[model samples]
Target: MELPKDPAMLLSIVNMKLRDFYPTLTTLCEEMEIKETELTERLASIGYEYDADGNQFV
Candidate 1:
């Protein structure tokens, strides 16, 4: 699947996947071919934060 161009949208999609599909950060990153740091950084740039225990963007 194509990654969202917008960081906010990307964060939303990723969080959705985390909530409904993947069970862990490593699984999500591997499946999405995204780096954890890069994803978190991009999300943060758009004012989103990853809650590890919750496994969603906040």
Candidate 2:
């Protein structure tokens, strides 16, 4: 699927996917064929980072 181009929207979609489906960032990225580093970096640029314990970007 195409990821949101807006960082904020990307954060929302990623967190939603993590909450409703995947167990971890790695699994989500793997299943979606996304590059984990790129995803995290994008979100991080907007002051959000993945929190493994919560399985969401915070």
Candidate 3:
């Protein structure tokens, strides 16, 4: 699937995947073809942070 054009929407989708599907950041990033740093930066811009152990945004 294509990444969302809106950053907030993108973050929401990513968080949803993390919460409801994926088990790890690495796996999600690979499936989405997104780099960890880039995804984290984008999410951070929207006030979300990745928690590795929890495997979701906080």
Candidate 4:
């Protein structure tokens, strides 16, 4: 499915997937066919960065 265009929604959805499904952002991106760079840049637009230890954006 296509991702939410809204940044807040994107953050929520990505975080949820990260928390429940993926072990790492790289895995998520590869399996889900999302570009890691774009995902990071999108979240970074709203001041969220991936925290690898927690596997979530903060």
**Model 4 TM-score, 2 decimals:** 0.97
- After superposing all C-alphas onto the true structure, candidate 2 shows an RMSD in angstroms of 0.4
lDDT per residue as tens, model 2, 1-58: 9999999899888999999999999999999999999999999999999899989999
Find the candidate with the highest lDDT and give its number: 4
Q: Candidate 1 — worst ten consecutive residues by lDDT sum?
A: 3-12
Separately for all candidates shown, the number of backbone clashes (residues 3 or more apart, or on different chains) is: 0, 0, 0, 0
- Residue-level lDDT of model 3, residues 1-58, one tens digit each, is 8888788888788888988889998899998888989888887887889888888877
Q: List the residue pairs that clash in candidate 2.
A: none
lDDT of 4 by residue, 1-58 (tens): 7999999999999999999999999999998999999999999999999999999999
Overall local distance difference test of candidate 2: 0.94
Give the total clashing residue pairs for model 3: 0
Over the stretch 1-58, how does candidate 1's per-residue lDDT look in tens digits? 8778899789778988999999987799998788889888888898888788998888
Off by over 4 Å in 1: none
Ranking by lDDT: 4, 2, 3, 1
Candidate 2 local Cα displacement, residue 49, angstroms: 0.7
Model 4: weakest 10-residue lDDT segment is 1-10
